[model samples]
Each structure stands twice: as structure tokens, then as C-alpha cells.
Target: MDPFHTYTALSHQELGDRLFQGELIIFSIADELAPFLNRTKQLINKHFGIPDPQKAHLALDEPTYAARASETMTAFERDPEIKSLFFSALETCGVNREENFYDRLVLRIVPCVTSYDKGRQASVKHHRDTWGSNIDSQINWWLPIFPLRKARSIALYPDYWNKKVANTTSDWSFSRYLAEKKATPSGEKIAYPSSPQALESIDEQACFTPELQPGEILTFASAHLHGSKFNLTDKFRFSVEIRTVNIHDVKHGKGAPNVDNAGNVPMYQWFKQIKDDKKLVL
Candidate 1:
């Protein structure tokens, strides 16, 4: 059965059990999330110099829009309050913010055009995050800064949970991509990212697209094959995502199955202890 299982709350760490089983969990809007959204929207709007971020593309050209979006996203990541609000929301949803380790807060503003897909566009393609990081014990938490529709939301390919799909994980490197990026001129768009990508077509796969509202949390295993939905709505979509790893899960090697991943890098170093911002040194 291709029947999908989605829950409304995450009250504890038993989440590892459900997530590794390929279940998707959705947490309702919480008091902590509201403040984060407010602050995020404020920063986004400020960076783009627009009152409504949905129409940000209309106000500026594609290149300008991308620069502004990058500025906003970078600013959001550097802001102290945004990080605090992020961890606070996690705590409200049963995550022990003080006990686990977390990666960086990734702010994504997706426009309708592909030319603007500069840095963080790889995840919008079909592939499990573990295909790149090689760490399956991480939990991916997504928050839509704006309301989502069919065209602007994300799609998870549940049918391929245990199936093998050809991918480019065996031939991708972030360091090489950066070196080539430096060789390119400043204003020109560099070559496409060499991140993990699906080599086979998944056009006929059974997919699940959940329409989420603002201030909601979409939590799932990092190994779930997911991608951005079609952009027929023509409106820009903004969202935030962060990954956390339970120290216990790490020590025990607990996570989803590695169906076809070819990556070998242990991405544990990017994570920092929640209790004390100490890096998870190898």
C-alpha cells in the first residue's frame, strides 16, 4: 500500500522510531513559531525593500531579486534573535533544544525562474539529504514562512523509500564546486551545482504533497526523498529548515536505511551541541 502516514504532533524523541520508518510528522502552529515568523518576515521584507515578499520578483529584476534574497537569507542566519526563536519553537514541539545538536538554519526563498536558483537549489531536486551528508541520524525540520499551495509546497516520494534510484552522489563535491565558482566572473551565473541529483526519471512515482500553513513545522527523516513542487503559482516561496541529531542516536548509529547512497563524508562536524554551542568535533 502506498498509504502515507502523517501525524499532527511530536511529543518526544520516539520520533526516531516513526521517522526511520518513513513517516512524516506535522506540528501545528505554536506560540513560539509566531514570533519567529514575525521576525523572519520583517527581515525578508526589509532586505527586499518590499512590503509583501510574495511579489518581490515583480519589484526587481531576476539578478537583483536573487542578490536581495541572498542578503535576506544570510542576514536571517546571522541574526541572534532568529536562532533563539528557532530553538524555542523546537522546544515547544517536544524537542529538547538543550540536549541535542543542530546544524545551521537554512533560509530558502524560491522564485519561479531557474536562473535564480543559485546556492541552495540542490535540495529542490529529487534526492535524500543523506545522499550528500551521509548522516542518516539527523531529523529535518521545515517551516514555511508563508502559506503553501500545491505549486509552491514540497513533495515527498514515499514510494521510493526502500527502492534504489540512480543518483550523482558518487561524483559530487562541495569543495570542487566552490573552486570552480571562484574561477567564474563576479556577475555571471556559474555552472550548475554538482550536488547529488537523480539520474533516473521519477515522473511516474507516487508522490505526497502536503499543503502547509504558515507557522507550521514539517518534520521528517533526513533520508526521505523529497523535492520542491511545481511552481505554477508563480509566487515566490519562502521557508526555513534545520537539522538536528540526537547524541544518543549518533552513538548508537540509529537512522533510516541507506538504500542507495554513495556518499562517505561524516557530516557530524557541522553540528553543534545545543547545550553549549560546542562543535561535534571528530
Candidate 2:
């Protein structure tokens, strides 16, 4: 029942082998379930904080979404177990990051609604996660803040990088715009592909569908092509998308200036309390 031990036992690399080169790796943590579930309830306490399925209300800011991101980041970071869970999970996956104790090494939290109560489930279109330059190779640890059914899950294409998506000068080049039209009709729109040939090359790569229960963790490469599916159940799908990168590789691209101003963003955030935090204790 020791979460850390079980997490350590799970061969993330083997999970990788089962995956296509660029496929996302999905797994869950056994040790941190109690605390994680508690945190989810806290986020939904109507008397104390914000409620879900509702937009920023008269009492809340119009951009309550951004505020929620900050709140979720702070809540998860405060829990030491979640911190250990992330680092251990990352190491299990063969990713190496630079060490800077107090920098925000972790990135923003992405919350998506796949299904709502009785309404059509919100779905994200097909697209790569992030494309800002200077953005070092990053990955996402997707954990459902609450339990999720297999049917109301995310869909991802394996080896997306091998697909040859183009970004040429033609007016018809494959940019985020076309991707929005083709993939995510409501979510983010992509610009031009960073590499024209890379898209087609990685096409037809196999992918896997994963439904993450509470405390389950799914990690995948930054460049992997992935997207979420509709949440068909009546209950809300509360999940967090935690993005991270190697601290040593922080200075990689045009994302540098923004990264600099962001004050090391997610990394600085990680080292701040990872050591003393007990949430990591299985």
C-alpha cells in the first residue's frame, strides 16, 4: 500500500516500450490517493471557494479560469506527496531535469471539461500541447482531481512527432489555424508547424486511450501529439495538466524571454517545498 514503493515498482520505461515512441504513458499512484481526493473536495467547496461548471460569476473575476490555475498550482505544490509523486514519476519515465531548489520548475495547470451534467461533453481538437519557442522540451502529468470513467477519457495519437505536419510558406500550409479547423474547433489554434516534414513523418503512428482515476498519473513527452475526448457522464471531470521541463534546458528557445520574465515558472515552484512535504511519504 506504500504509494512511493509501488510507484517505484511500476516500470515507466516498460510502459514506454508498450507505447509508440511518441505515445503518452499513463499510470496511477497508489500511496497518495487519500490526500489527493481530499484536495479535490476542497476545490469544490461552495461555501469556501469557487464552484464548478460555472463561469466567473458576479462575485468572481471574469477571468476566474486564470485564478483557478493559480489556486490549483498552489494547492498541489503545498502537498509534498504530490511533489515527490511528480519527480519520482518523472525519473521513472527517463526524463532528467536540472536542480534548482526554489525555482518554479512546474508550469501552468490546464483544466478541461470532457463532459458535463446532461450536456454535450466538451472536447479538445487534435493538436500538440504547446508550441512557444524557447519552450524547452516539456511534458505533462495529467491527473484527474477526481475519479473518471474509462469512457469519459482522453484520446491520444502515438508517435505524433513522426507525422509529417508541414509549415511551409504556402497559404495552405499546416499551421495551428488549420489544426483548429481540423482538430480543436473550440480550444487553441496552432500557428505553422515548426517543421514541415515532421508532421507527415509521424503520421499513422499508433496511439492509446487512457482513463485516469483519482491519483493516477499520465506522463508523456512535450512533443507528443495528444488531445482529450468528451466527458459523457453527468459528473464533472476535474483534472489538472501539470507541465514541466528540464531545469538545465530552460534556456532552449524563443520561450526564453517569456520564461525569464515568468521567473522560472514551474521549476521554482517545485523546489520550494518538495523536501519537507510529507504527501510524498507513502
Candidate 3:
């Protein structure tokens, strides 16, 4: 079977099974998310006082960029219209949002700028989600807020699914990272202090599907070795990433293999309990 499957090709059960088995899936519901994406762009422009969303990339260098971005993301997530639209989009894509508890979805608005600064790289380095979070059963949903053309998208190294890579996971602790992240104020010189130094040594045999259209969602397990490809384009990359986990899988240890340390705390404070109609207090 192909490593990548489309939404129409799999049922909800199949998608769940495939994800646990370490496969990635891509599907499009761009039409459903168009309004929300537009609203997000508008919100960014309004918050930053930029006339053009494309030109908004220049504001990333501002001292208040992280705080401003976090505020904008909170507003976007709290907007009733956007929340409803996003939930509907998840349902349309075969995800039972109620059944699977999720962490706060993040709005990633990456500019074309790259920083050579150590410990505070603008672009992500090759790493697995397990390195930062304890949820071995976590599954990530990623979608582009705008169309991606040419070689501009995240790549997954499928060849390393079961292969080991030399990383800093042994010396890195998620709890320490989280504490440091929280203690540091927005716009400060915060860094992922223990980022793997051997990332460049990893082979480049990755699956880079750069033709992802707007509204297409990429779903993959947290254990997948993935990272951003160099954004050669001048346009900013707007995207959203939400992580979900099946309680059953986590309880039974049925998800992807975990080799990294568990987080000191779960990434979320509460989960939307789907089965009993009651909130799952974590």
C-alpha cells in the first residue's frame, strides 16, 4: 500500500488503524475551510495593521511578533464561526472530533525569513513529536491556509519509520523544555535548547509532496520523522496543526512506538469527552 492515502480512499476506522500503523494520509476539504482561512488572514492583517496579508510576513521581525501571533491565534480559535467551520471540516474528513481528544490547535504563520541564530531557528529542524510531548498515540492534522506551489511543504522521512537516528532525546526532557517555554516571555530570546545536532546527517530520502492545495489536510502519527523543507518562495506559509489522541490507544499502548521520554504533564488541561458527553479532566 502507498504511504499516502486520500480521504475518499479510507473510512474512519481505516484511517485510525493506518495512523496507528505509522502511515500518512492527505485529503482536501479546502472549500469548507476557505472562509475560516480568509478570516484568519483578515485577523492577522487587522492585528498587525498590515494592508496585505502577503506583505504581513515583514512584521514577523517585530519584537512583539510571538505575543501578537498568539493573540491572533486565540482570537481565531475562539471565534464561533471559525470553530464551527473547523469542527465541521474535521467531521467531513472522517475524524470524530468528539471521540478523539485534541490539544489546542496552533496557527503557524511562517514568514520567508530564515534566522541563522543558534537555538532559535525560524524553521523547524528534523525531529519527531515524541521528542517534545509524551503522547505516543498523538496524531497530527496539518493543512495549508493558502495554496502551496512547487517545493514548499513539510516533508516526512518514511524510510526512518523504524530506523533509529542519533538525537538528543536522551539529554532532553520535555518537562524542562515546557517549563522554560512558559517562563520565557513572548518575543524573548527563547530557544529549543536541546534540538538534535545530528539532523543534517539524516539521509534526504524524504517524501516531499509540494503540490498540496489549500484545504487539503495531511494526517500523520506523531512518531513520524518530519520537518519543513526550505521555503524557496517569497510568500509566507500559513498553516494550522492540531494534535489528537485516542484515549483507548494511549491506555492500551497501541499507537506508534515511543522511544523518547514522556512529558511531565499532558499537553492539554481538558479533553472533549466524546463517549459520555462529559469533559475529560486531565
Candidate 4:
């Protein structure tokens, strides 16, 4: 089967089967999420005192932009209202959030005003999410905070579904990386290692989608090869992503093994038992 598949609509069961089969699923939830995303943008602009958060990236240096973005994200994540709205949105989309295990969701704010700016480095290079602490069975969910055109959206390399790429995971230490990231000053983003990897040479065949609106989501397994495409547009690209794993799948060994060694420890230190809210050690 092809690795990428787009759906106009899907039931909860269909979404689960497709995800477990390692296929990419794109579907809509726009009506349910637009208002929440709008509020989030307003909060960011208010926090930065900028009329347009997208253009603000052009005026500030990389570190300053990262700091301000981080501050806004921190405030947004800590807000109880935002969390409630997000979970509600997920439930409305047929996701049983109560039955899944997920760490905190993340907001990604990319401010790139030009093609020549170093801010392009902020865009992710081709890699699998499993290279992080994510388990192989984890399903990643992403949605743009604003409407995203094809040129500005992320691209996936479907041909590499079962192929290997030269990466620096052999020399990387997940535990050390986590500790260093924690030690870094607040409001700063940590830079990953810049060693050359095979992904740098495989861009010609990547697949980019049509414009993805605020209410839609794109999901794929941890092993999917994906990365950011250069933002040719003048505005900043903002998005949110979260990863979830079904404990039953994990316990039954129903998904791929963690051969990539993405991290020394599982991302969530403890998985919340849906029935009783007990902490299950990973």
C-alpha cells in the first residue's frame, strides 16, 4: 500500500486501523478548531505586543524571536482554557483522548520572512519522529495554526518507508540531550547536532500536500520520514503537534519495534491508565 493517504472523513475506528497500518491520514476538524486557533494567535500577538506576529519574525534576530516565541508558547500551554478546548476538539473529531497516552502537546512557531535568512534552519530537516524519544508505535498529530499552502507545508518521503538513512543516532545520547535541554535557559530552543545525514540528499521525491486549513490534521507513525519545507512565503508558519500511543497496542507488540533507538527513555515517564488515572511505568 502507498504510505500516504488523504481522507475527507474517517470514523474513530477507521483512523485507528489506518494509523496502525503505517499510513498517513489527513482529515478535517476545521469547524471545531478554528476559534481555538484564532484565540491562540491573539494571545501570541498580545504577549509580544506586535500587531502581526508573522512579521515580527522579520524585525527580530533569531535568538530574540525564539525567546519571545517560547514565552508565548509557555503561556499558551499553561492556560487551562486552551487545554480544555484542545481536548474537546479532539473528542469532537472522534478521538477518545481519555483512552490514549500522550504527553503535553507542543506549539511550533516558525518565523521566517525570507529564503536567505538563517531562520530557515529552524525548519526541520528530513528525519523520523522516532529519532526523538517517541516510541515506534506512536502516532504524531499535526495541524497548522493558520492556513498553510503547499510550499509552506511539511513534506513526507514515502519511498523511504522501510529504508534506512545515514543519521547520527549512533553518536547521539537521548538522556544527555534531555538533561542539556532542561539545563538550557528558559525561552530558548535547543539546537540539534548538525552532522551530515542521508536525508539532506533525498528532497527531490518528497510529497507536499495542498493547502491545509486550520481545522484539519495530518497524522503519521513515528517511523514516517518527514521534515519541513522551506517557507517561501513572507509570513511565519505556526503549528501544533502531539503524539499518542494506544497502551493496548504497545502491550501486545502490535507495532514496529524500536530499532532506531530514538531515545534512551520513553518520552512519557509514565503512561496514565485511562480507567483509574494511575501512573503506569514505561
Candidate 3 at 106: error in angstroms?
A: 0.7
Q: What lDDT does model 1 reach?
A: 0.78
Better TM-score candidate (2, 4)? 4
Give all candidates' CA lDDT scores.
0.78, 0.43, 0.66, 0.66
- Each candidate's TM vs. the true structure? 0.90, 0.49, 0.81, 0.82
Per lDDT, the best of the predicted structures is 1
Name the best candidate (by TM-score): 1
- Provide the RMSD of all predictions against the true structure, rounded to 1 decimal: 2.4, 10.8, 3.8, 3.7
Instruction: Give lDDT tens digits, candidate 1, residues 1-282.
Output: 534444545655578888888888888855668999999989988898977778766678776776777688789989988888878877877777555898888898777666655554322678788887788888888879888896788888888989899998888887787787888654455575545889998954587877888867888898888887756676788888888888778788899999998888877887998767898764
Full ranking by TM-score: 1, 4, 3, 2
After superposition, candidate 1 runs with Cα above 4 Å error: 1-12, 114-123, 181-194
Encode model 3's per-residue lDDT on 227-257: one tens digit a residue: 7776777775667777777666666666777
Better model by lDDT: candidate 1 vs candidate 4: 1
Q: Give the TM-score comparing model 3 with the true structure, all chains together.
A: 0.81
Give the Cα-based TM-score of candidate 2 against the true structure. 0.49
What does candidate 4's lDDT look like per residue over 217-268, in tens digits?
A: 8887767777777777778878887777777666665554444443455555
